[model samples]
Target: MTEALLELKDVYISYLGVEAVRGVSLRVTERDFVTVIGANGAGKSSVFNAISGLVKPAKGEIWFNGERIDRLTPPQIAGRGVIQVPEGRKIFPLLTVKENLMVGAFMQRDKKKIAENFENVYRLFPALKERPTAKGIRLSGGQQQMLAIGRAMMANPKMILLDEPSLGLSPIFCQQLSRQLKALHNEGKTLLLVEQNARMGLSLANYGYVLENGELRKEGTSAQLLNDDEVKRAYLGV
Candidate 1:
């Protein structure tokens, strides 16, 4: 069997002395699209932060490509191709679209590879291609989200951990974002997404884990979770 591309072993996170996450574990295999769905304060972003090495776990381990990475720094983990598109579409407000994308490739040394990544990002987000010089702050909400994803793509990541990609998008933009994400998955990109939009998250991912108050409340194939009565009532508003 193929080893998991990413795994978290009984992880725990704390803020000051307060526990934010408690013994959460999950896995993502190659080419898999996985999602974690929950309400606000469910510790979804905290988990992504731990995976990105922004915040160290107070307990447990994180493994990527069979290597223990819980002890690594943020840059070290990012160097290993685990990139995160953080919540709130944190693109640089003053940077032009192309400039913002180039920031993601700062670690790359190959000039040709950087060019190729630019091409790929533009292709994935034609709106960015059309306004390559526009300041990031000028882009609409959907476009900013696109730029955030594009920036992460510029890093040539093996896996992307996206935190709440659909948060404030209009229904139309959400639909568009969903299609773009699905296209990325089809192209063999491994993704781990966290979202409060339960229906959209579950629909897009093949496998899902539900988080409730910083704990793993449920885990199943997306189809299974979509049909689950408890999940329906609590998350899907069914």
Candidate 2:
């Protein structure tokens, strides 16, 4: 088996004295697409936040590329190439698209490599290439999401943690976003995704886990999870 690029070992995360993720153990292999699906309040996004170092793990460990990262700061994590595109398309509203992307490259000083990453992002997101100077807030919701992912790309991440990327997108836009994500994975980018849209997520995921009320309830290869009676009944609406 390939060594995991990211691993969460019995990770527990809390908020305001209440545990949000309890003993969650999971892994994202290099170049693999993994998704954790759950309903709202199921602690899925908390897992991502912990891995990205936005919140400290109250217990357990998070490892990335064979190094412990649970104690790292959020910026430190991103700088190490474990970038996250948070939910809600949190782009810099006042900055132009190009500027926002540049901010994602803040930790890198090599102008040549930065330029190359920019080229790659633009190639992946042709819509972004069309309006590089548009203020982030001026873009449509789908466009804003594209910018968020493209900005993360500027960081040249070894793996990306995405939180509910389809949160408020229209169905059509969600379909398009899934296509983009699949393309990214197909091109060998590793991904760890937290999504509430179970069917959509499972459709694109190579492997999946189900989280419920702060604990893992089920896990399997995408085909297995999709065909699971519990998953189909609880999340897939089949």
lDDT of each: 0.96, 0.92
Kindly give the stretch of ten consecutive residues in candidate 2 with the minimal lDDT sum: 72-81
Which stretches of candidate 1 lie above 4 Å from their native place? none
The C-alpha RMSD of each candidate to the native structure, in angstroms, is 0.7, 0.9
Candidate 1 backbone collisions, by pair: none
Best by TM-score: 1
For candidate 1, report its TM-score: 0.99
Evaluate residue 214 in candidate 2 and report its C-alpha lDDT on the 0 to 100 scale: 97
Worst 10-residue stretch by lDDT in candidate 1?
A: 1-10
Off by over 4 Å in 2: none
lDDT of 2 at 100: 96
lDDT of 2 by residue, 1-238 (tens): 7799999999899889899889999988999999999999999878988988888999999999999999999988887789999989799999999999998899889999999999988988898999999999999999999999999998889998899999999999999999999999998899988899999899999999899999999899999999899899999898
**Global CA lDDT computed for model 2:** 0.92
